[model samples]
Target: MSKKVLVVDDDPDVRSFVVTVLEENQYTPLVACDGVEGLEMIQKEKPDLVILDVLMPRGSGIRLYRHLKTDDALKAVPVIMFTGIALRSFLKSQKALEEFKGEKVPEPDIYLEKPVEPQELVDAIKKKI
Candidate 1:
């Protein structure tokens, strides 16, 4: 079976772009506009991976990540955060930043920045699986 990807983003263009890239690379893509819907899709579809965004009107990516961590069923699901904000910029302290490296966080197996390169996105997904 093909690996499925759930992509959550508020922007239509970003969602479209992600879906296109996933499809072009032969992965099935599911999209959601907000955290609520994205969570619902997760429950229903059980995708192989999730490509999450940092900024969404309904809820931030961190919010959704926190929620995912709370659920035992969802905790193992790999998420590749696609954020415009650089991870280093968000890391406050040197110690904390060093601790966060490759930790899957409200924890991810992998992380990626946007606008995501199609090949990079595909590589991340494959690596997660």
Candidate 2:
């Protein structure tokens, strides 16, 4: 059976794009609109990997990442941080700031910027699985 992938993003366009790409790559793609729904789906679907957005309504991707990272059963699942915030400088500064504030910001297995290339995403998922 093909591996299952969960994509959680607030943007419908991003979800559609990722889903289409995943389907073409022969993977089962599950989607959630926000982090809260994503978490629910994660429990229900138990996807092989997750493609997550950083910002969303209700709950954030970072929140879900933390939950998964801490949960013994789910911590092993790989996550990909897919966001519009892809600047290396910004990510570094954000990490530093969060560290200074004593916040725990765990890095995802892979980080990709918005407008991800289909081949790139598929390759990343294949590598993870």
Off by over 4 Å in 1: 89-106
- All models: lDDT? 0.81, 0.87
Put down candidate 1 lDDT per residue, 1-129, tens digits, no spaces: 788999999989989999999889888999999888999999999998898987787877767876786689998888888878777754333236346653434446676877767888878888888
TM-score of each: 0.84, 0.87
List runs of model 2 lying over 4 Å from the truth. 87-106
What is the TM-score of candidate 2? 0.87
**Candidate that scores best on TM-score:** 2
Which candidate tops lDDT?
A: 2
* Per-residue alpha-carbon lDDT of candidate 2 for residues 9-32, written as tens digits (9 for 90 to 100): 999999999999999999999999
How far in Å is the alpha carbon of 46 misplaced in model 2?
0.5
